[model samples]
Every structure is written in structure tokens, then in C-alpha cells.
Target: MVVSTRAGAERSQNITVVRQAPPMSRTVSAAGLGAVGGMVTEYLFDPELGRSRRARLRDKGVRLTHGVRNGTRTVVRDVRNRGQGVLGAARYRTTGREADDEVLHERVRAELGRHVRHPREVDVRVESGHVTLTGDVLDRESRRAHRAVARIPGVAGVDASWTTHHDARRAPRSREDGGPMEALQDLFRQRWSPAGRSLTGLAAAVVWSLSGRLPRPLGYLVRAGCAVLAARAATNLPLRRLTGIGAGRDAIDVGDSISVAAPAEEVWPVLSDYGLFARWMPDVLDVRRSDDGGRSQWRVSGPAGVPIRFEAVETAREEGRRIAWKTTEGQLVAHSGELSVTPEDAGRSRIQVRLTYNPAFGAVGHAVAKIFGADPGRKFAKDLMRLKSLIETRRAPVGAGAGPRE
Candidate 1:
């Protein structure tokens, strides 16, 4: 007779088989035992939860042939189609010593683009992951370029010694960042311009008159104010190109947009993961979140590995849509940025990031920052590309075990 028995929702169930026949008889008469088992065995099965195939086996049970169990290992395997063996081994090989020439070339090109003003002018040749950079480039660019190439994941070595900086290849002198004096001169020259020269003259006359009429202390303040305003106005005017200064502007603005073949939900988690930002963002040495997790501080390496530190807070956010941040405190550089995610048809998303920052020392600091690939626009674009590659490819995290596949 069947005793009390019940099954869980799991496709498989715990079962107990009680032995009554003699052990000798059971061993010697397999066919006879099978005949008796067919008439005595009972199963308790539940169909509501058929997702799992594992079950526990217990003792202390009688059998009745009235019920059925529908669990099977093959069914679960078919549903998920999981793979076995070295997980991510192929990906690891592709990113390391076993990387092919094409992979190495791509990495080299991307790196060169970030540091060199004219990447197309450089000749990049990669064989067995050894890189040879040959082209006419600036002296400073050549040094920076070689160092950057050496740091790529698969580059065995860099050969750029033959690279020369010719006068012809040298950017025009006008493209150089004139010092503070030159910037002041550019603003003074604008006093004769047709558009705003009248207003400029009027403002100067007002400042001069006010300075004489005001008391000594207030007069000094008026003159100082006039000087500061005049300097700012000059820096804003279109002046000769300053070497290393982008767009002749004191502040840097960078923007980029990319299409990712993943849903917004899938991309948001990776974007908000501040700890891993350093992994995809170049030059970031370390990043930490505050105790409340609302603020983040970043330690970054600048040219020649000089340390630059900054703290930022998330200013605004929308779930699965966008995030905006600004530096609350920093050394050498101050920055603000935003990232937006938009859903398109299918399971694709368009992701965009924009960043703007000004150096603490103005034009000089801006020029020095370019030496380290610290340009906000250039950094933004490269970081976005890295992010795109990581998310779309779904590669395993850097140090995950090969035994388990996620």
C-alpha cells in the first residue's frame, strides 16, 4: 500500500524505497525483482514547478503504482543549453599574448589616436604583437606616442626611435597657446573691431571715470575689476591657435555618441559601477565611493604618471536613462559631465556622454594636460568606445574563474 507522500513544486522529488525482499533473492533474481518492483513502486510528483531536475532520495516509504514522476535531467539541459569546459579562455587568449596581428593593430591605432594629433600621418605596423610606429610627428608627440603604444594590452614592444619631428610636420606657431601676455594683447587688439569696439571703448571710459571719482580704496577696486574683465574678454575672442590648446578656448568640451546593441536596463548597471570606471577609462588609477555611496573620488595619473585627484557627486539621475555629475573638489582640473541613454527599436540603445572642464591654472594647465591624454573630449570618446566594446561583447570580467560561466 502507498503510505503518506507529497511532492514539492520542483520537477524532481525526494523518494524513499523500502526493501522487504531478501537481499540474496534480490541479488540473484534481478528479473524477478523487477517484476515485483513494477507492482509495488509509487511516485509523488508535482507539475506546477517543472523548472529544476534535482531531487533528494530518502528511505522509510512503501510503494503504490498509482502516481507518476515527470522530472528528467535532459529537459532541464535542453532549456538552458549550457556549455562546459574552459569558459572565456578564447577571449583571454584574444586579449593577451595569443592575440593576432589585427587585434594588436586595432589597439595600437586606438591608442595612437588618443595621444597623437595626426594619427593618420603615423605608420603603425604590428607583427606578432610587436608594434613599429614610423612617421613624421612632433618630438613631444613621438615620446608620448611610444609610451602609449607600449602600454596597450597585447603590444610586445614599441619601435618608434626612427620617428622624427620635422619643421614641416611641426604645427604652425600660431597654433601654439600664447602666454597670458599674448592673450591680453589679442583682447586689446579687439578694441578696434567693427562689431563691439564702441561698447568696448564705452566700458573702458566708464571704468576710467569711475576710478577717479571713487575713493582711493574703491578706485583701486574699480581699476582691478576693469583689468580682470578685459583679460576675460580677450581670452574669449578668437585668437591665434595656441599649441596644445584645443580650439583656442580656456575650457575644454568633449562629446561622443555610440549605439549599443543592448537594452537600457542592461547598460545602466555598468555605467553606474564607479569602481570599474577605471577599467574602461584610461589614466584612471583608482576610484572609491563614499560611505553613503552618493559621492566618488578618483585618483588619476597624468603625464609621466603624475597623480591628479578629484571628487565628484552625482548631480542628477534618471533610472535607465541618464546621469549627470560635477566635480565638487579637485586638484589641477575641474570637470562636469553627463551621460544619457535612449532606447531604440529592438533591443538596442544609443548612449552619449559629454564632458567639459577647465584647468586650475588656465591656459598653461590646459596645454600641460594635453601631454597626458587628459583632454576631456578625447578621454570622453575613448572611454565611450571602451564601454561600448565591453557591453556589446559581454566578455567575462577580468579575473572571473574559468570553471563557472555566468
Candidate 2:
């Protein structure tokens, strides 16, 4: 959610927070007793009750520069509010550890993004200048907003020195207070936690491996067998060269496509972001591109109990238009691929992936893909389908680049 403030129009929602809403803040004049009293009263009447104390600082004019929920404590750690101008010695929240400082910034960014209502315009950036804000807000009510953002956990000071023009919209989005302070409420609403489902799948695998239930053999046996096979495969020089399981190998013949209810090119953007590999590739660690060139790398979590290591080498083009590579070196040696984006009608993209891996164990290797196949492979397939769902529906990607590898 975002928080926005236009020049003059009134009708905004609550405070809009965005990106990583951490906490909210405000400044107060130590000398103003009435202002402080008003703030105290406001806190006593808040809805969440958990964050009501935040209102107490509105003492001076008793402002609410921030709308974050960082416990219920008024702090004295800001430089701009220090009265004197050194660092610290002023006012702010103490999250206990300094390492968690980024939380404050993300939180503030979230707050502003999710709550920005019909404001003339809103822009944020960090520069050598006094941190400028050059948009028009609804009323003077938003003046504190600029101050609020400026007094963020680590912010130095404000340069609201920019001029504020006049103009405001009537009804704004609901998440954002009917005002300009709401533009960050749902910035990352698409996030989905796969823990429950992943755990269930793991459990099923366990069950199948232990007691013979369905049409398959015991799960443990398969796993143990796979482990043994993987161990043997890793030690095998030929196998080592095939999958590129350990050594930093390049992905070969990388041809992937999205078969959605739409057409090709729809999944372009998501596919373009090489870093997005983390989100789609299962059991994969980091998918990176060498700064030296377009060559890509995959750090894969080695099969069972093994540490993470380079699993494949890859190369892509047209921002993923044509992705192909070879296993320069892990699990499968001399791997190659040709991923094509064949567009399907009805807004679906038919992504055709032709991957060929040189398996040292040949048939034995095929067995591994068979066991873990249905699910993870299906997951890989499902991600493409997900790419379809998200692409066709024009929805945002699930998480930040990727979720934990399955």
C-alpha cells in the first residue's frame, strides 16, 4: 500500500504503506503540552490498539509523520529532531539491532506505496540533495507526511523545500486512507507461502518410501536407492561430466517456452529477468549471469545431504527469447537445450522446452528423473503453467524473484 497526498482535494483513505512496510513515526515539540495531550488522547482511541501509542507523539501539533507499527515506544534517536544537529541524540525507534535497519526503510517504502491516494504526483529517491519531494498534496495535512518520511529510521532530514502545487481528487483507493498517504497496501499481496504444500508433498514421499501404499514401492527405498545411485553417479567421471552437478557448468541448449491461455511473448518479461530463476527452478540455489558476458550459472542444491554447488551452465538471449546452454561441467554432463515460446491461442502461450542431457548412467539416470519426475518436473511444468496463469491474467509474480527451492 502507498500513502499519497494531493494539493487540495480531501477524500483519501488511511495511510498507504508499500513494498516493505516496517514502521511509522512522527515528531513533537517538547514544549507543547496541549499538542502532547491531544496525541495521548488519539492513541487511546485507535482501532488496532496495538499501535495506538504512536499517536502520543502528536503532542506538538502532534504529527504522525510515520504510520509504521514498531511496537509501542516513543524513541529519541533522530538527528534532524535533535534540536542540535549532530547524529543520533534525536528521536526514532530502536528495533534492538542495527542490522535490522533495512527493515525500517522497506517498511517506510511499503507504507508510502500502499497508501498513496489521488495525489498530483509522488516521487522518492536518495541523493546528495536534502532528499527532495516535489509533488502537490491535498492539504497542509500532508506536510507532516513529507516530514514523516524524512524522519524515517535512518533518514537525516527533509528538503520539503520543493514547492507544493494545489489540486486533489475526491475518492481514492480504499486501502490508502481516502487521502494521499495510501499507496503501498498491496504492493506484494501476491506472495504465497508454499511451506504447507511442500511439507505435505515431502510427507507423501516419506509415506510412499516407508510403507508400500499406492501402486508404487516404499518411498525410503526409492530415496535410498536414488541416493546411492546419485552417489555412484557423482563419483562416475562420465556422469560427472554429464549433469554438471558440482562444477560450475554452463547450461546448454536452453530452450524453454510458456504455453499459456494467451500467445507467445506474453511471458517475456518474467522470463527476461534471469534472476527470476530462483522462483521457478526447483532445488536450485542462485541463477546468475556473469558480469563479463551473457553467460549464466546455476548453483544447485546437490542431491540429498550434499552441500550446494554449481549444477549447470547456461546462456539466454532476447531477454530469454531464445535460451540455450551446455553443461560445461554436474549431475548431467554435456547438457543442452532449445527453449521456444510457441504462442497458443486463447491467450495461452505454448512453451516448448527441448532439453537433452548426456547421462552417463543412461537408463539408471532416466530412473532418477522418473522418481522425482512426476512432482518436481510437474512443478517445473507447473511453473510454466503458472507463468501462463500470471501472464494471461496479467497478475504479478508470486514472490521476490523466487521462493525457496523445493
TM-score of each: 0.37, 0.32
Q: What is the lDDT of residue 226 in candidate 2?
A: 50
Task: For each candidate in turn, give its C-alpha RMSD to the true structure in angstroms.
Answer: 33.9, 33.8
- C-alpha displacement of 73 in model 2, angstroms? 80
Top of the candidates by TM-score: 1
Q: Which ten residues in a row have the lowest lDDT in candidate 1?
A: 60-69
lDDT, each prediction:
0.63, 0.48
lDDT of 2 by residue, 1-406 (tens): 1334452234544447678643443223434666888776776767778254554434423233342222112222231243353233342354312324355445445545544453335545544323455554445545656756765655555555434434444323213336544433221222212332233344555654665453444555666555543434233333333344432332122234554665456566665555655555544557777886556666655555354544345555545356666555424335555555655567666667666554334434544665654333455565566555555666645652344444
TM-score of 1: 0.37
- Stretches of model 2 off by over 4 angstroms after superposition: 1-258, 305-307, 311-320, 329-334, 344-348, 358-360, 368-377, 393-406
